[model samples]
Target: MKQKRDGGVAVTGTADKQPNAQLTSWFVRSGWSKGELARQVNRRARQLGAHHVSTDTSRVRRWLDGEQPREPIPRILSELFSERFGCVVPVEDLGLRSAQQPPSGGDIDLPWAGPQTVQLINEFSRSDLMLGRRGFLGASLALSAGPALLEPMQRWLVPTAAAPRPAAAQGPGAGGGRAARLSEQELQLLESTAAMFREWDSQCGGGLRRKAVVGQLHEVTDLLQEPHPEPVARRLYRVTADLAALAGWMSYDVGLQPIAQKYLVLALHAAKEAGDRPLGAFVLSSMSRQMIHLERPDDALELIHLAQYGSRDSAGAATQSMLYALEARAYANMGQVNKCHRAVRMAEDTFCDVRAGEEPAWIDFFTEAELHAENAHSYRDLAYVAGRSPTYASLAQPEMLQAVEGFRRDDVHQRAYALNLVGMGTVQLLMRDPAQAAHYTDQAMAVAKRVRSERVNTRIRKTTHAAVRDFGDVPEVIALAERLSEELPEVAEPA
Candidate 1:
């Protein structure tokens, strides 16, 4: 009763009901003989305590014919294939990537280049949900055409045209009353969101929860674009812009450099729309932090200059110190030792100039100990680039110790403190004192266990690995290494 199909293939009741030849091809390409793969899969299933094992080749063939594997089998199949191949075999190669690719422009009736605003919003939502799952890594989240699609989206978010003044500016008092009220509301929202994110960043690592922040930002951006009274809208725009900048920072924290860059550009536009010159400048400084991470010290310096220029009149002493300290870190990374020292001096001078009670709430996080720790970090970074110098060695010990003490206070600030301890442990390892390094690293790991932070754990592991390599035979160091190793999942090795 079957009819002959095109290409000389036999067809079943419907064209859609035909076997998925592509799946079979993938199995062959994966380098496993059909019988061998089936045997391995059965062994893995039995190991997982499956009550009954199907030894039939036909059952396995049906799975290759496009039937989805039952629970735990998919993971088992992945493990077997990966073990045999000696690399990660993505689920996609098993014909199980996603139900479908994102809609094409033609299908959605959107511009070929630019994503429709609505489509972009939906993608943000999807990315957030996908990213929130435990162990979800975005390293494999590649768009079909690479990152070029995001360029247009970034450009659209950052309008190149001259910003128009809000209609309220023409009103009798320039909508002062409404603007004030909106500003208060926006401030509350910003403070609340910032606190929540800061806590999460300390506990779960910015990498884990950052996508949700990005999603929330997209929602805020949509709200900003909606028609509203001018004053209120402008305030919302500014607040949303700051949130967007924070999202960019989180993206950078997780090593998503391209996406982070795009978000920063969009954040600049939003900041400008609200006439918050200082906030815009602060965002630019944050951009410099990403540039530093990317090892583009020259670019970081230029961005810092731009930030300083933009906020020259508006920035207070604390803000000035932060900007200078960040610039010093960049210079340190670049091996410009003298320039790094000079920038650190400038930061200290600026901090000294801040009168008691004159500091802004936004800059309250930068304390004396934090400043010194930053300087120590800059020195450590410089040592890595330029080889250890007497100057770096001298500054490393005292500053790191101070940082550790300050981080001991019970608060969200503990995250940064633990991070500094790990940094110090790295310096100790570099100094060839494995016992000392392990001591600090162990403390950092203890703090990391209490906090749900991926970033902290990542840093702690790096320090621990260095210590282990230097003193693998040292009993204390070996024990600490074993403990930390046991904490990570066997399948998910610590990076």
Candidate 2:
């Protein structure tokens, strides 16, 4: 809750410990000219969900003259300096620190109360849908940057001391009708549309209908502003959270990880407001997946613990199984083979007990196939840690193949199935069978052509890299390499 110093004029009394000196020294050490610093700061601000800023060298000059930039600008400056210097650079160090104030969650806090959550979602949805708002850093820093986003979530870990009391519905504003009784038909329509969106995302990849889902989520937020009976309001919050979470999931699929993180955090807010502890837990679990993909295994582990904490004892077999599966992945990344194996066993055991209707509908994607596929990935990771043992490859190939086949039988998530095909291909290549690896890779490409998933493309790239690096001289590898080179320049001829 640190405040920034006033930007109006130069402050006297400490010229020897000059704020200007600190700014100048750091600015010089950074090797970025004043203009470059301005550009980078503005970019980072946008990523942190700040209003549009076009800071310039003149603004930097003002800082050098002992005047501070207001509020978040100082915070943004600290972030850039810390990232550039590889150390913690507090606002105090930047000479812009002022008296502490109450924490408002620094632009990312989800209001779990009433209409504020709806307003937050509306603003976020609009900003995200507008391509002009995208930062130059893109989505890569979403989870990788770590603490900025995690700090807010860490605060969310503590439950509210008082339970939320429902407020009377507000009368119609200029935009829409007053609070009205929520009809059964309205809820049914939302549920059906969500189901349809899920099907489309699974079949054709998130790119096929991501915008549609986000727009629907914005529409659903309107229902939150309307007054309903306590029960109806609670149900409305739950469904809205579900839609928001879906939007986040699709954003992840299409490689907009920052936007995905934003929506997921908002969804977590809505879920908590609805008293849907299980859904809240799932959102944390989803965030953990994003962290792992960002290569932040330790951060991912923290999110896993938070997820399990939310579920406590009420989580069903399927939910518990999925959580453990994610834990196994986290451990695998950390090279904790024994812990990873134990978690895999836990997931396997719990999934065995999952009854047909035990799982929430949203988690229908976490079937036996996903468990097997993730288990294979965990095992494959152990092999890397243990010096690439052929034994692990032998074990991994069958599990990945089973996953691909399972997805095939369901006739859903073709992108996932294709990605697993690439996994199997990689395992075969590691086991020194170029011909079989080529066969699997070809099959994967055939399926992959129908989907627009960055994740699928990433797997395809890995498979191709293994082929070219290890067995490029082989005729089968050569042919597949040629095909990949023609189709994906980034994968075949990486910079």
Poorly placed runs, candidate 2 (over 4 Å): 1-111, 132-148, 155-157, 161-178, 488-495
For each candidate in the order shown, give its overall lDDT on alpha carbons. Answer: 0.63, 0.75
Task: Show the lowest summed lDDT stretch of 10 residues, model 1.
Answer: 106-115
Candidate 2 lDDT, 1-495, residue by residue in tens: 233333332233343334478777888899998888877766666665564455778878767777655546766676577646634465667777533322443445555555677788876776666642344333212223356656677655567643443355432342333457667997888878888888888888877788788888888887676666667778878888888898888888876665677788888888877888888888888888887776677878888888888787778888889999999989988899789989999999989999997677888888889999999988877677678778877778888888978988878778778878888888888788988899889888878789878777767877887888988898888888888777754522111
Model 2: residue 300 alpha-carbon error in angstroms: 1.0
TM-score of each: 0.65, 0.75
Q: Judged by lDDT against the true structure, how good is candidate 2? A: 0.75
By lDDT, the best candidate is 2
Residue 35, model 1: Cα distance from true site in angstroms: 22
Clashing pairs in 2: 179-227
Candidate 1 global TM-score: 0.65
The sequence of per-residue lDDT tens digits that candidate 1 reaches over residues 291-360 is 6655567767777777777778888888888889988998998898899999999998998987667754
lDDT of 2 at 210: 85
